[model samples]
Target: MSKVDVQLADVSISPVQYQAQLLAALQMRDLDKFTQLLDHCRVDAFSSVLESACREADCAQFVQQLLQHGADPNILNPVLLQTPLHITAELGCYETLQVLLCDDKINVDALDWLGNTALHYAAQNKDQDTVLALLEHGSYIGSRNHAGDMPVSDIEPETLEKFLNTRLKMPNDESLLFKYDFLVPPVALDSALLKNKLSDEKDNVIKKLSSPSPEMDPIVQISLSSKQQHLLLHPIISSFVHLKWQHVQKFYYYNLAFYVFFVLLVTFIILHHHITAIDEHRKSCWLNLSAVCFFKIIMITLLAICCFCLIFKLLFQVCISPVQYLHKWSTYPQLVLTLLTINVLFIDSGTGDSAVTVITLFLAWTRLLLLTGEHPAISICFHMFQKISCTFLKHLAWYSLLIIAFSLSFYALFHDSKAYIAEKNVSSKLFHNPLISFFTTVSMFVGGFETKFLPFETASGTSHIIFIMFMFFLTLVLLNMFTGLAVSHVQNVQSKSELVRLTAEVNAVFDIEKLVLGNPVCIHMWMRRLNLSHNAVIVGIFKSFVYLWLSFSWLQCFRNIHHSVLLFPDSSFDYANIVYPFGNSVNVTWNYRLDHKVLLQAANIVQKKNDEARQQLDCWAVFESYEERLNNIEASQLRCEALQQEILQLLRLR
Candidate 1:
């Protein structure tokens, strides 16, 4: 080769070498090498290489340095067809672009080779955070790029819409332009042929809805009406909002019953104490017979009231819903408090000896469990457990704390008691033997209202142990029964929730039948307005109607009566006969069964009717689109005519 040819080859290879070296510097992520190279290269000459580097990796810092050193910020790299900033942004080098954007000399709104601005690149990448940053920097959102696509067009329409809607709703974002821009764009005009096409779509919808899932019962699915919203809301209403006069009456009666139970319980304890006193000749003979007879009368009266109230409460709760159960349950602690107060008032005689007073106080203490729902007496013991280092240690600590508290409270009130006033009575035991006090206190705490005398072989030690065992057994049985009830209730709730889900699925797939009688929506809506899910069949019958009215009236009477007691009756647990506990004729067990039969049939009819209404609504939506398009066409034509008139006027003026 000639020397002139060699020089020309070197000249041709120089640009390629420069480009490769710049790319290497960028690939190395060495900011300093990039600065030195860009300082030497001409703006227009190296623009292609710079843009290519930006495209391959984040080169916003390099681009900014070059721009500050007098490289043209708006210059395009012809080979790669990208601007440096545009490529940097598209690659999501957010911080690099942030520093570059700080330079006032750079044209922030400059478009890349693809006709996309930096804002367009950000939106296309779904980088909303970057898009907001670009907008904040005064990037022109409306400006079309080389491809005639605006920055907004780069955004996913749905995401953009949601963002804009959120912004519109914010009090600080009062943008009239945004409001006008989203005024639901009109659909393109469609002909009669298009309406026929919609009929085909309706048929498709019907077919899609016709097939029932194998998991769903086909018979039930075919029967539901479309208009039935979930009736589960009924339970929520009863729980929170519907605290009717019925609830108030039940509370009043419950409180009265609880008062009677308290009185009887106290009398029973006092009688045992009196008998012990009589045996010891501690009380005067005259005081003994009077007190004993008074105790007996109190016991009998209390039992009668308890029975009456229990029966009343059971009658009231028979057809109630779970939601109403929660409402009624909330009143229990208050009722209990009232009962406890009544016992305290009658028993707090300053003349009574420690034996009589202590027995009365301990019986009253048992009412503390009723305080469980209102305040967490149980939680106090649990909290102490948390401070313990190990699991078993925690349990041990909790039981220790409970026993200690029980002993302290028992001793504080009953230290002077002389009955079975064991060699270690409250005062002596509390001062010298805390362990003894704990066991004794636990025995009394566990011992329920059943403190009847059981003749043991006349040995004091043997009798004491037998009494403690009886108390433990009684407490355990009551606690176990409560736990069982709670478990059963939770299971019932789960099953009911699953049943509702199945019902909803069935309703979604149901078919419709035309009725000559009337509009099903009107019928269904009327039912909803009446709030009559299970009240109908009961309301139809005279006996059931009378029973409901009586329940309401008795509730009113309870409200009016100053001293009437309420009793809750035990409900049947049979699912088929179960009654929901809210409203007239609703029993959890009974209403559920009734609802299963009647609701299924009624909902099936409603579902079909609702489906037809929904289809009509869909048709209306299409019609609305057509009318909007016509309005837009007419509006555009008017604007064009006005523009033409303005031009004529300008010409005349000239």
Candidate 2:
């Protein structure tokens, strides 16, 4: 049963007395005293409901009692001029709001100082029920707040349309209709549509959007300003990037598999041919290949095949973007290592070419880290390594001055002192060169401690003070300071690691795109390759033979990939039928006076949905042109009529 909100019999009571009684009843939840005061001015029903609401499910009217008593529900908070209902909806006080909305006298459309109505707050907070309730009670749909944002601007249009129409009765206000009158411009006399409009708009948009240009990408540039470049990690955009990476990463894996097997073969060759050298200087050496056996020749042939595959991969990548490939850290390392491995094929010299191969082998294994760094989970550590190493290198130049200064001073102080330089001592050897002292100082900074490899027998008191000071400054202060800064930086980077991973993902994706859809050169190359093989009988047969040879079980991952397919050829995606799914159920009446949002496409998603929406986007341009043509024809007709009327008037006068 519905309980009375308030029933104050005494009309003789002052507004101050009623306001004081109302605040007390709401705060204390004492319905007996409140009802005693309200009937004689009492609040007993209000207190019982407020207190019992927790234990009982069917408690009638807590705040609903206060509303019945003419306790103003529209009371503004003074700061924002927001009423109780505005706060309730904004803070998501659903239970109290139900009670408040039951009393119709509560002003649902009350505006704050920012001119935001209760509906604006409800929509912003994403309170669907409050938004519907306010809309049902006639909240203005087209009302722009002081920020020039309507309620729809904050809330999703899909959600509002889904809930509002099915639930609430349509309001009578013109603003509630939300129909926009899209104005088309009047016609120019010239035939602009034939050629002029091509240069004007469409061509420029295609140019800006066709390539991997940074001009259109918004959040992708979010990390550009940051110290460590990171991509904006939105759910939709990140997923798109991940899918894009999947399309292109198989080539890298193919090349990586070949390189990995090649390194393993190099390992086997090193072990089989290695020997302890009789030379005093060299401890170990590779045995010369004087007796080449059948198994050895097969291993060599396998190595040659791996080398051929890798060289082809390198050439393919380099030709796609020569300048980028040459300069890239990823490409140049692989190239240098491959060249070193090739050197062993020519030179049979003992220990030299095998030594080169050993270095390449070390790099080949280490390079696995770089290859795997493209992955999102692992990229963070590599990014952190890069950022931290960069921090060290940039600061190392400055710190080198201190090491040099200390080294030179130490050398100058005791270089020629007969007492300090013992015949068999390391100091005698080290003090002979300032360069040795500088290098030793640097080594000591990392590995060892103290200035002495030996005790100073007869150094000055000034030298002793200097030695203590150098140790204190370099080891204690400087080292700890570097540690603190690095620790702090690590902590800072930890917070932004997710963003770093996303940017690395974007970087990895675009690296693949640079060979396919993104670069002008790559796209041209794609089209060129397609044209060469494009339905040509001989070329198709050659490609078929090549693919047949490559159709090994191991190459399954790369079998689906081909150059012609990389161009992302147009498919039967029906763009012409692209239409808004909701037909008449939605009504979003827009005032023409509001400020328009400037941006268009999300550049990261870039034209993937162009098949779905491209024609519809271009339709507005054609419609405008058609409208202008009609206007021009109508205007000419009016002028011709006026001329004929003038001629008739002249004939009548004669």
Model 1: residue 259 alpha-carbon error in angstroms: 85
The residue-level lDDT of candidate 2 at 269 comes to 59
Runs of candidate 2 exceeding 4 Å displacement: 1-231, 246-252, 267-296, 348-350, 353-362, 414-428, 449-452, 513-654
lDDT per model vs. reference:
0.43, 0.53
lDDT of 2 at 174: 19
Tell me the lDDT of model 1 at 404: 71
lDDT of 2 at 415: 64
> What is the per-residue lDDT of model 1 for residues 72-112, given as tens digits with 9 covering 90 to 100?
55556655445656866788878667766776766566644
State the lDDT at 200 in candidate 1. 40
- Residue runs of model 1 more than 4 Å from their true location after superposition: 1-16, 79-81, 108-115, 144-149, 153-654
